[model samples]
Target: MQKTGIANLPLHSGKAPYWLFKRMVALSRAIVELMIIELGREELLRRLSDPYWFQCLGCVLGFDWHSSGVTTTVTGALKEALRGVEHEFGLFIAGGKAKKALQAPQEIINYAEYSGFAPQPFIYASRLSAKVDNVAVQDGFNLYHHTIVFTAEGHWCVIQQGMNETLQTARRYHWLSFTLKSFVEEPHEAVCCDVKIPALNFTAKEAADLRKAATILSCENPEKIIKEMKKIRELSLPERHMVSLSDINPENFYKIFLQTYEKQPSNFESLLEIKGVGAKTLRALALTCELLYGTPLSFKDPARFSFAHGGKDRTPYPVDRTLYDRTIEILKKAIEEAKVERSEKLAALRRLVKITQV
Candidate 1:
């Protein structure tokens, strides 16, 4: 699986008003239905996994284009729009903001049972993607929203968001299962953000050596690693390193180190999957590895992209309800006509081509 991108947006509060939300659901359903019909479900999934396309989608659905709420509101609308017709389209969405994000596993299980497809891989992908973002990549943004959209054939896309309250900004992460590879190594296609702060990116390719060394250190007896941690803490390290002595408390991580010592993970990814291994634990290990092996860890922040139609927040203008409704009706009609009339479908495709050329 490949994580495609991360998008940064200003943190905004409050919900989409009821009047707008209802229209959003209708419009989103029509657009998604048309896409699935014309471009196929996989293509829709691919587009959703692209941060740029997703931002445009939120805007087209009449949400604030550059606000944090775009991630949640747009995805929430999609989930609502897809309700009762998942089997027909072969696409299913799981998870959402806050507590709703925690329900992803069970939702995937339910979808899998209905479709007669194995669910464990999708479940693992969901969990590991979240784990990679939240723990392996210490970007100083704690994730608050998580969503996974999957197809009947088992292809999946993960769209998750994290917030840096201190910074008052939100970052959205995108993942697609189109490519299967190592999760902990250079998984992002791009990261879009206005500001790039130093982050502990263990997933960067530069950190391969650090990952290996950390995995090795993890397998050692907890007492030995604890002693090394204490030694590193006492040393006067260079100021350039992001991990400080205060960040790594050996006592706090002693139990986790013991768990890793027993499990003896074969690789960094395996070590990451272990219970209780989180940002602080990984930081402690990374700091120890850097001091011992002279391997450099990456503290590079990964970030990477827009809008159409009037926005709900009235940036360009308030949501034009009449135009929005008319647009929805046209899309629904086109989809219906395309199903029964070849010429109508061809005409729609031609119009799309002309629009794209513009």
Candidate 2:
């Protein structure tokens, strides 16, 4: 069974201090080496896809276990440390925060061809994963960092994070290639965060009809949406008619339709391929659908605990002792095998003690 838990990752600013960061790199390398040597690349990827395991990894590496920086700093350290060591682990890291993230497709291509595998599918997976989290999920967080690690044999894992500025929190989304059954339906291995807000998740099973309606709307002549925008714009308002499509200028919406009209997107994924389409435009269309077609949309957040061992507090359910013991044993074994200095190993153990305290 998979173990999962949400950790509060408040967005921390500035760089991770050089002293701490260097050790984090060392510790990270040790752990990854241990995972590869003992459990193998597939297991390593599987663990990285688990929110609880990933958080625990960040914690053990001596970062602010609960800081949003863990997602970035830990992945960054692994990227740097893993360089030139790909042969040993059979895993390659690609994509990253901002500029580095934009380099992912090319990075994947470079690595893939070098590793003797085709890059197109990997590239598509990378883009669609980002799109699903950023658009299909409709969560308020804005994704600013993305990191994908794939094995030479093609299994991959994604650990991307988005920031909720108003709340000073970051939500981390995990994806494992083998674990996902559908990109648009419960794609995450886990989504761990500090808070759960009312979010529009078009990708959710609960939003099936809403997604269908929205997709149907997208398939309609883009001209209709444009015409609807004109109607909303022309309608007299009671000082505040609370706008959606009204916020969109007809000319801009017309350009979006022009891009899609030619293709006539058969599905929501196809519609997303249209160049100018984006969240704001999608929101307008979804709202329009609700108003016109009365297709109900769920605002419920899809984030869940779904733990192997329930929360310590046991609100939803009691912790499963056997699974909890197994998780502890595996982590202990990895920590023991990590090839760091004696003092550093002791320090890592001490940090493990701090996990429960945190």
Candidate 3:
């Protein structure tokens, strides 16, 4: 799938109406069933990991295509639809908004026992993905919704959304287990946000030196690292700057400092696994790396989909009602027909080929 640019996702409040959501679940269940039958489970996971395809699927399923709520609502509908059918499809979904997000590890563990697969790695990826987006990518967005979809064979996909309170927008990050080689270096298949901001992204390839230096600082006596941070925090930016050193807190590093000192982290990823080693602490460490060791991290927005679909607020082009209705109708019909025996379903589905072509 072609990776598109980041699209706008306005923070839309309120739940999808009961009537519409029911239809969404029905239609999505059928669509996913057909997809798995035709393309296999791994291919389904790959498409879900593609932000553009996932967004389009949400629209085809009848949610507001450009609304941030689509990320949560679509995943919720899929979880409902996929239940009782996981064994046949080889896919399972875990985690969700708020409290549901906390259930992912245990959910994976349970699935592991049932499927006879190791749970630790899956659990680690689930937690690390959240940590990477929440802390490593220092965008202003705070993640409140997380979803993980995986097959019995261990292929997985994660679709998570974070909200920027000040901007009233949401950013969604996508990760594919099969495509990932390293968790720390540009691991995401795509990141979707409404707009760009000046954010510290320590995971960028340009930040290799900063990552190494931060690892070094984390391995040393946290107190010594703390002292180095103290010196950097003391440095002035310019003669007339709006922000001050007091605005930056080096003290937040104490928890990770103590943890790292007690059990030295062998590498940056290991340091990231420590509890309380979050954004502010990592940010301070990066600053310490730069100030003390002359190694700096990048401040680039890592979002890949920039030229994307129109926003709900009509920033680009308004939503095409005709296209939306046709999409829903096409999916609804194809799903309804797909429930039948092979011969009938094939004849009926071939008639809907024009629908999928779009």
Candidate whose TM-score is highest: 1
Residues 17-48 of candidate 3 have per-residue lDDT tens digits of: 77667767777877788887668889999999
TM-score of 3: 0.84
Listed in order, each prediction's TM-score against the native is: 0.91, 0.79, 0.84
Order the numbered candidates by TM-score, best leading.
Answer: 1, 3, 2
Q: Model 3's lDDT to the true fold?
A: 0.79
lDDT of 2 by residue, 98-181 (tens): 889889999998887777888887787788888888877777888999999988777899989888898888888889998788
Q: Which residue pairs show collisions in model 3?
A: 4-305, 5-305, 5-306, 6-305, 6-306
What candidate 3 gets wrong by more than 4 Å, as runs, is 1-3, 238-252, 306-358
Task: Please give the CA lDDT of all the candidate structures.
Answer: 0.84, 0.73, 0.79
- How many residue pairs clash (N, CA or C atoms closer than 3 angstroms) in each of the candidate models, in the order given? 5, 0, 5
Q: What is the C-alpha lDDT profile of model 1 across 71-179, one tens digit per residue?
A: 8999999999999998788889999999999999999999888889888988898899999999998887799999999987878889898888988977778888886
Q: Alpha-carbon error at 152 in model 2, in Å?
A: 2.7
